[model samples]
Target: MFDWPLLRGPVPSVVVILGAVSCIYLLAARGRRGWWSRTVPIVVMIGVIVSVIADKVIDHVLYSASVPVEVLAWIGFGAGAIALGVARAWRATWWQRGVVVVTVLVVVAMAANSVNRYYGEFPTFRAALGLPAAGEVAFKSVSAVVEQPQLPVSGRALDQDWTPTVRPPAKGVVTQVYIPGKVSRFTVTRRAYIYLPPAYSDPRRPLLPVLVLLHGIPGSPSDWLTAGGLAATMDRFAAAHRGLAPVVVMPDATGSLLGDPMCMDSRLGNSASYLAVDVPMWIRRHLQVDDDSRRWAIAGLSYGGTCAWQLALRRPATYPTFIDLSGEVEPSLATRAQTIRVAFNGNAAAYTRATPLHMLAAAPHPSVAGIIGLGRADTTFGPQQRLVYAACRHAGIDVRLLVLPGAHTWQVWSVGLRRSLPWLAYRLGITAP
Candidate 1:
C-alpha cells in the first residue's frame, strides 16, 4: 500500500473512470420534485463561484502563486459533484443515500488524485502519509559514524587528488538533525536533513565540497528529500563518479511548513541571516567538509530558488554558484507594496536595497555564476525567469538559462535538479567542467 503510485499508472485512471461513471449514474437516477433539473444547475453555478474565489484567495492572500486552471477546474467539478450527491440523497431511500455517500467519496478521491498528479507532490502512499524515506536515521547516530580525525583536502577539486576504489560503500547515508539558529537568533525549531556521500566514509576522509539545498514555501526540508528526490538523485550521481559527490545539506529556510520568510531579515523572520550565516557556519563546524567558500553552492525550487538567487548575489563570496528552479522575478509576498509594508515597515528604500534586481543592476558581479531553470509551460514564471536572466546577463554575471519540460510542479523541479547536477558538480569542484 505504501508503494502505491499516486501520480502515474492504472490507479489514478481507474479512479477517474469510476468517478465519471458515478457522476453519470447520480444525475440519471430518477428522483421526485425535478431535483436533478433544478439542483444541478445551481450546484454548477455555486461551484464556479467557489472555484473563482479559491483561485483568488490562493493567488492574492495565501501563497501569492497562481494555481493552474486545470487544478481549478477539478476543484469546481469536485464541489459540484459532492453538492449533487447530497442534494439527490435528501429524498432517496437509505441504500440510495448510502450509494450517494460512496459516490461522493469517489468523486472527492478523483479530484484529489487529479490535483496530486498535477503537482506530483505525493508520488506514493508513503509520501502522502508523511513518512520519512528509507535509510533515514537520527542525527546522533551520524556523529559516531563520522567521528574521524580532521583530514582536510586542499582548495582544489576533489577529482584532482582522489581516485575511485571498490573500497567505499555503494550508497550514502541521510540523517535528520536539529540545526539551531545560533547566529541569526531566529527562534524557529525545525530539523534539517543531511546527505553524506559514500566517499565521506573513506578512512583518509577527504573534505568534500558542500551544496546547500533550499525548499519552496509551503514546504519543509523534507520536500527535497521526498518530492525533489534529493538523496536518490545524489546517490546516482555519486555512483557514476565513483562515490564522489558533494555533501548535500537541506536546512529549513522557512520556519514552518506554511511560513514564507521571503529569505530576508525582516520583521517576519531573520531567514536570510539564518540561511547565509547560521547554515554555512553549522555545516563547517559539525560536518567534515571543505571550508573554502568557493567550494560551496546553493540551489532551490520556487521560493527556495528565489532565496538562492538573493543569497548568491548578496553574498557572492560565500556562494559563488547558484541554481534557481522556477523562481519568481524577485522575493515577494503577494505584491511589492505588501511585501514592503509587511517586511520593511513600508520603507521603500530599504525594500529597494533588498531587491535582487536593484542589487544586480547596482554593480557588476563578475565572480557570481548561476543557472536559471524554468518550466516550458510555466506561463507565470517563465516570463519572470526570462526577466531575471536578462538582468543577470546585463549585470555581467555569468549565468545560464534552461527551459525544461513541464509546468510549475515537482516534475519540473525534480528534472531541473537532476539536469543541473553535472554542472553543479563541476562548479563545486567535484568533477571537471
Candidate 2:
C-alpha cells in the first residue's frame, strides 16, 4: 500500500490534508450561529479521525496480503456519516445540513485516496485504460521443434540447438511452464510463461540468446505478455530478421501472485534464490539456451524492476546485463525504517549493505551493463532513477538512461521495452555488432 506522499508526493499530500482540515474548521465555526450546527463539525471530526486510522491499518494489511477489503472500511465511514446525518437532518438548519454533506464527502474522498494501493493486476490510471486486458494476451505451450546451428556459437558447444518444427507466423509462440524449484526450494508454487521467437521454429537457425523477465508486485508473469506487449514486440523484431529473436523467459519473482518478497531471501519467501538460482537452473534444464552471462539478461518493471538490479548486481556471474523500467532506487517497504524492520530484521546496517545503490557505489568498477528507463513526469521514481543512473555511470559501469512519456504508467514501460530491444539484442549477442 502507498501513502499519500508516495502517490502524489509530500507537498500535495500536505496541501490536501490542510485543505480538508481548513474546510472542517470553517464548517465547524459557521455552526456557532446554529445550535445543531455546532454538532456537525464534531461528528465530522470524529468521522475523519476514524477514516485516517482506518486508512493506515488497511494500507499496512493490503501491502502484505494484497486484498480489496479496504473498500469495506471506506464504506463503513460513509455509512457512519449518513447515520449521524439522518439523526440531525430534521432539526438542522439549511446551512448546517449542507455543511454536513460536504464535510462527509471530503472526509470520504481523503480516506479513499489514503488507502489507494490496489490497482488490480494492471498498470496505473492511464496505462490501465489504454492497454489491453489481461485475457486478451495469448500464449501457447511448446511443441515439436527442429534443432539447428548457426555461425558464432555463444559458448563451448555441448547441448543440441533448438528451433520450431514449422515456421512461426507473425506473432511468436509463448509456452506455459511449471518449473519446480527442486534445487532452490523457494516455493515453486506459481507457474511461469516463456516466449520463443519465430527463429526457434526454424530447423536451420542458430542457438539464440535468452532474456529472463519478471513482472511487478500484485501481478503475475502474464503482465509482460498482456500489458507490456513484449511478445508482439519481439515477434515483430523476429519477422524482420527472418525469424531470429532472443528467447524470452518470464519467471515468477514473487512466490504468490499478490505477495511481495522484495525479491530477497527473507521471511516473505526465498524470492532471491527463486529468481537468481531456481529460475535460471530451470530454464537451462527445460530449454536450449545460451547459459553465458553475456547472453542471459534479467529485467522487470516497478517491484520486479528493482529486483532486476538486485539479481544483476548480487549475482553478476550469472546475469551481467539488465533492464530496469520504473524501478525503485532500492528495495522499498515504503520508508527506510519500515524497510529495515521488515527486510533486515530491524538492522539498518544490514540493509545498507544490501542496498543496490550502496553496492554500486562500493564496487571497484564492475563491468555491468544496464538500461534504465522511466517517464519524465513520474516525479516519484523519475528523479531516483536518474540518481542511480549517474551513480552507475560514475562507478564505471556501462549504463544508459531513457526519459520517456507517460507518467509512471505502462505507456513508459511498454515503450521502454520496444525502444530498448535493439540495444538488448546487441548486448545479449542476438544481433551482430
Model 2 clash pairs? Answer: 163-200, 164-200, 164-201, 199-243
Report the number of the highest-lDDT candidate.
1
CA lDDT, every model vs. true structure: 0.86, 0.69
> Model 2: C-alpha RMSD to truth?
9.1
TM-scores for all candidates: the values are 0.95, 0.69
User: How accurate locally is residue 149 in candidate 1, as Cα lDDT from 0 to 100?
Assistant: 38
lDDT (10s digit) by residue, model 1, range 96-137: 899999998899889988999999988888788988777887
lDDT of candidate 2 over 140-206, digit per residue (tens): 3354443544544543321223334566566667767787766667775666878887676566555
Model 1 bad stretches (over 4 Å)? 145-156, 164-166
Give the Cα-based TM-score of candidate 2 against the true structure.
0.69
RMSD list, candidates in order: 1.9, 9.1
